[model samples]
Target chain A: MPQLVTVKVNRPDRRPVRVWVPVLPVALVLFPVVVLVVLAAIVACVVFRIGVVRALGAAWRVISALPGARFDIEQGRTAVLVAIR
Target chain B: MTEQRKDILDMLVAGKITAEEAEQLIAALERDQAPATGSLDARPKGKVKYLRVVVDATDNGEPSRVNVRVPLQLLRAGVRLAALVPPQALVKANASLSDSGVPIDLTQLKPEQLEALVEHLDEVTVEVDSPDATVRVFCE
Candidate 1:
């Protein structure tokens, strides 16, 4: 599995937020919050007759496109795993 | 009592129209002419123009200023547009932003969720000043 990376973003007009990416599904230290959120969304899409692999693959592509944002890994993975279960 | 006189009396009793004005109004009414209070146009003007973010800083020894005029409606439109974005796209953006040092969850943006956040911010001014920079946010 790629290490999940967590990203933190602080906005002036909105609440501070975070995102997560599973780095190549191999960078074990990456766990981003948005990754889990997207995971849930992908499942929802699948439930709605969408393709799971296609959705997951698209999500990975998004995570790959981010700029040099900060990321966390270990904690995000636990959260993601818990969310999955 | 005449209808116009009654209105003036009501205003006087409610302390809206002054006593002298009420008397004048009543005298005007006695003359069988209507009086114009002219209160409608007395409303205060100059509503908030923009949500302004002014950034004054010296970057590399050169003074620079950034004025961000974020329309209230743009925030609404942005949040609405987010919903139209597929979750996969958001996930990709999230990854990209995280790598760029922005740790924000793009998937959580919703128009309704921003209502309270924007409400408390309306008309509020936030100022931050450092040795090299000053940042001001307000509804101008």
Candidate 2:
């Protein structure tokens, strides 16, 4: 995947910090998984009479907090702060 | 009254207050008005449409601005997809984050607990103000 985000952090009296966050490989790896999981979650929600969006939302919560999972999280607050100013 | 404050009143009378002094009056006439009601928690809740980041600043004496809108659906999809990354990639990301002084262990991120966070974030607005710039991130 190409670099979707190229953070060019310029700080006075120091070399700039260039961080390239790629998006394509991540998308490639997750597309199939998202398709499968979302479909199953939707089906389960329907069977149990649960709202589909709610069920999907619940699943997202679980997945986002999972160990090794924050692939989609915004950048670290501390990191971004340091980079900005 | 200070010249600025008196000018504010004059501007109001002259019908020019609508341009700038309208809001400036609170600062000029009522210094304590803001602190009396400076409560973020008191802000009303609203449906979230997008994750937005806005920056207004100057670089090298030139004005610069950035406005970015991240669809919530993209975040949802990305979180859902993280579950599929191979263990090797997770290790690499974890090491990289730690080495960069971020102190976050991606390997320990749990998806189950992420829902509560995302829900709360839907109501969050982070505003960063500095001498040279103002930045804000919020869901709206």
Candidate with the greatest TM-score versus the true structure:
2
The sequence of per-residue lDDT tens digits that candidate 1 reaches over residues B55-95 is 77777776666555655544444444444466777899999
Clashing residue pairs in all predictions, respectively, total 38, 15
- The TM-score values for the models, in the order shown, are 0.38, 0.43
Interface RMSD of 1: 13.4
Stretches > 4 Å off in candidate 1? A1-85, B1-47, B100-103
Residue A31 lDDT in candidate 2: 97
lDDT of 1 at A24: 55
Evaluate model 2: give its TM-score. Answer: 0.43
- Worst ten in a row by lDDT for model 2 chain B: B77-86
Query: What is candidate 2's TM-score for chain B alone?
Result: 0.62
Candidate with best DockQ: 2
Fnat (0 to 1) per candidate = 0.00, 0.00
